[model samples]
Target: MSKDYLSVMPEDFSDFGLSQPILKAIDQSGYTEPTPIQTQMIPSVMEGRDVIGQAQTGTGKTAAFALPLLNGLRQKKKASPQILVLAPTRELALQVADSFKKYGTYINNLKVLAIYGGEEYSGQLRQLSKGVNIVVGTPGRVMDHIRRGSLKLDTIQSFILDEADEMLKMGFLEDVEWILEQAPQQKQIALFSATMPSSIRRIAATHLHDPVEITIRSKTATASTINQKFLITNGMNAKKEALGRILEVSETDGVLTFVRTKMQTVELAEFLTELGYQAAPLNGDIPQNQRLRTVEQLKSGKIDILVATDVAARGLDVERVSHVINFDIPFDTESYIHRIGRTGRAGRTGEAILLLAPREKSMLKSIERASRRKIEMMHMPSVNEVNKKRIEAYKSRITKTLTEDCSFFDDLIRDYCSETEASVEQVAAALAKLVQGNSPMLLEEKKYERREKRERKQPVGGRNNRRSSGRSDEGMERYRIAVGESHGVKPGNIVGAIANEVDMDSEYIGRISIYDEYSTVDLPAGMPRQLMKVLHNARINGRMMKLSREGEKSSGSERFGNRKNGGKPRRSNPKTSRKPRTASAV
Candidate 1:
């Protein structure tokens, strides 16, 4: 039977009958009350019953499972993976393993290892030989270890699947099934997914035994202290320009900017440095120790801006990160939530600004629904506004100098005035010119005014007086890709890959529809063969999508863009404003 929870939560972890050790760790984490997911999930897992959770990302699901699992852990002398956690990505595997280690810190004789494909196998092999109570890994690497006889599942007491639906979408359903069969001796199975698709449901039915299902239906809203906002920016140049102006006008001590790719982190950081902001780039390629040092610098105010990707910025908690700027729109609401979460710490108000083009505006609604808050439209910071801010700061500097003991400078200036017979005002004006250097005290407004005029004249939904791929689209034409719903592809993956490969703004892309065997996308109605070749070779979900015109042979020559149900378009990725499906958030 299925169970759902929408009631008042307990105020403390002690109410869940947790062990003293687990309770102590919870207290150290500064969590005074249990989240909705933790409140609903802890009791079931403590009862040793299988659980299936329907939660969206950012609902505190990790702690929900980790706390209960740690509370019941019985450290054995010969640890051979008493509990197994299968994740979709190596990054998640590491995160989950870290949580396990943290929560179980008070327990004696506890060991955890995160195994994935890219890392060296010798290290993993050494860990396994040393004996670990918990083994968290990706499906492929786990399967490899199982085949190599390094990982044995007969001793596993519980098996957990984190983000089961994501694994299915990433084409890991078969691998997950194989892992499940290998652990038939496991006592209970815990499956967590954002949504309950038919495939996931089938696996739950086949694997779990009389499970207690829990769903946290509460509105997953962002922190009320954050002022969520968005800017309608088109081309890359426009985004960079807007960023500089916001940085100048915003009341921020430190800013964290997120981008989609590592290359963008470097490029945007360099651009910000050129515009007179102390900025640095952070990505996964950077060593772990260096990443920590960079975060430390941000906290100490040595650098005011840090350009980073999602993975690099994970678990970053800095009280001074007052602003989070999304230089590029995130493909999913979960990522949007994670990005903004870096700020709004230590009871201070935070600001999250999303930069969106005309085409990417559709994602705005998804982010709002997931966050359960309205992101008000933010006016582009005008040149006049920037000038006013600079003038204030300049005057403050002058006031500070006047308060200091300037006796020697005053005497020297008096001597100069007497020698030249110039008035004190004239001498002060010359000194002010020296302080200002060659640059004007106020920002020039002519270029900004001309750009505003051009923006006002541009047509709706077109790039703001800028072409995306160095060419303007006359109109849109429908095209088909070899990937489809069967391949577990989403529209954002299609849009992200296309926009990145061609260096074009997402605003040029049009409506998309996913079908059973193939998908349809609307692109610029063009006759360029070279660009077509580049797109044709683009891969999605590790499969080369043979992108071709609609009604092509590779598309099965069937025009099903309009389905039998009233000839309407069906976009399946973005969820409705009511119930969100992602549950990977902390």
Candidate 2:
């Protein structure tokens, strides 16, 4: 077929030829027009042609393959497995399976099962025994099933490799090849990959029978729909604080926050809920029923935010989700696209906010290049903005309550004024103050003080000078290390390690005093107990840290004089051998 053949949308599936129930479900799901990938690949697969689809993430790839696979399912046959879909990660596998489940829900005798690592194997085994029509899984787990003789491909009709490049990147090409070899020779092979590296092309040429090549060029296709922006922060905690501020300022109807791990899904959901957001967690650990319910609630406006791992939120269609927050940067560009695609859906304008730490800024550039669109840098909402939003929200609630129920409270207010022997104006003022207690508007003094403190605490220059005076202050812990001026230990390494491991910013780390025998670094006061333990167990330059106060007996040499000297440690050149001086000698 000509390359132009794939350029135009297919007319054959214009009607979808799906059963009435399936068509109704699709209509209810708000799918009006087919995405380019879906339009090109669905008809080819329906024709039983070995197809090669090249498209990036967020291009409706799941439906591109799922619609045809479901359309090909036989109604009267025994529920023996007929279609196999191999995906790279557990998240993608579950996502594809969910797509199949939704589209195939109306098809009788079609059972789709998703198998992947980190889940119960026996349950999958039992499901396999019961007979499944379609199986979507990661390569290694799929190979395990095949090895266990649980997944029989004897009657397989179609095999799809979704995100083939990702599977290769994850070192699953061997398992993919092995599984392909095990499948029936007559089976139709459809390979879908974001980028067709030579290796994937070789597989397509060898396995596919003169496959129709479809390439969907990446461009500013979805960029206009998505308002992409990034927030820069010192570190993770600062990112969280910025996220809270952004949420406060945003007028989002619903939000989806993408985190890296399932544990983070629960943790962030709980944190958001505690911050007075109606939030819930969506991850692999949540039961499928609950996952579906969560999505429905998000759609119905019961929950304002859904914290999810990529896997759990796949195939989720929540049209009201106006905002998508990347709580953690995705490992790959494709994942980033998919995460943001959760918003700006169905032709509705949506916003995607990314929180990037200093180190993660590089990944942002990579995503920009891959997506072929620039993500604008977004300033974090300042304290003033956050306070304004809070006050506005408070005012709106007050107006609504007063408009709806002023009669009931009028008697109570009069009684309070009479009992206190106070004028109505005075009582009303007191009531207003009580209602707006401790609001951000009232905390401007604290906010200003904190901002002033941060500005005053900027670090001074020079390695030696910084080490001497950096951390010699109240609320600093002195940590002793074996490597000092002799071992080439620098303040940056110490700061970098602590910042990376304990989620502390470099600014919070204090002075470093180097000596011939060892070095002492000052850390922030009230460091989490867990972080302190981590520091105790941490090794820098293969030397364990023995952390203690500055005046502790273990601090061998007072390279920097005690607090009395104002953290001005004696300077010594590493090239010259000088006797290490102690505090007592000074």
Evaluate all candidate structures by whole-model CA lDDT and list the values in order: 0.77, 0.73
Question: Per-residue lDDT for 586 in model 1?
Answer: 8
| Tens-digit lDDT track of model 2 for 59-177 | 77778778877776775546888899998766567768877888877776678899987777899999999889889998888988999899889989989998887676556787899
Looking at candidate 2, what is the lDDT of residue 469? 34
Which candidate leads in lDDT? 1
Tens digit of lDDT per residue, candidate 1, span 332-396? 67667767877764345789999987667778987788778889999989778999999899889
Residue pairs clashing in model 1 are 56-582, 56-583, 57-582, 57-583, 57-584, 58-585, 60-586
Q: Output the number of the TM-score-best candidate.
A: 1
TM-score of each: 0.72, 0.71
